[model samples]
Target: MHDWLDEEDDALITTALELMEEQRKEQNKTAARGQRAPGAGGPQYSG
Candidate 1:
C-alpha cells in the first residue's frame, strides 16, 4: 500500500516539474518580446 502511494506521488511530482519547465520557457519568450501593456495583467509566476 505504501509503495503504491509512493509511486503515485513520484508520478505527480514529475508531471508538475515538466509543467513548470514548460511554463518557464513560455515566460522567457514573452519576456523577450517585451512587457505587457499597462493594466493588462499577465501570468503571475514564482521560482
Candidate 2:
C-alpha cells in the first residue's frame, strides 16, 4: 500500500510540473506575438 501511494504521488507531481511548463511556453509565445504587433498597449502601472 505504501509503494502504491508513493507511485501515485510521483505521477501527480510529474503531471503538475508538465502543466506548469506548458503554461510558461504559452505565455512566452503570447508575449512574443504581442511584441510583433503594431501599437501594442503600453504597460499599466498600478500603485
Clashes of each: 0, 0
TM-score of 2: 0.66
lDDT of each: 0.72, 0.72
Q: Write the per-residue lDDT of candidate 2 for residues 1-47, one digit (tens) a residue.
A: 48999999999999999999998777666666666773463442222
List, residue by residue over 1-47, the lDDT tens digit for candidate 1. Answer: 47999999999999999999998888776665544553233553434
The C-alpha RMSD in Å for every predicted model, in order, reads: 3.3, 5.0
The superposed Cα distance between candidate 2 and the true structure at residue 1, in angstroms, equals 6.1
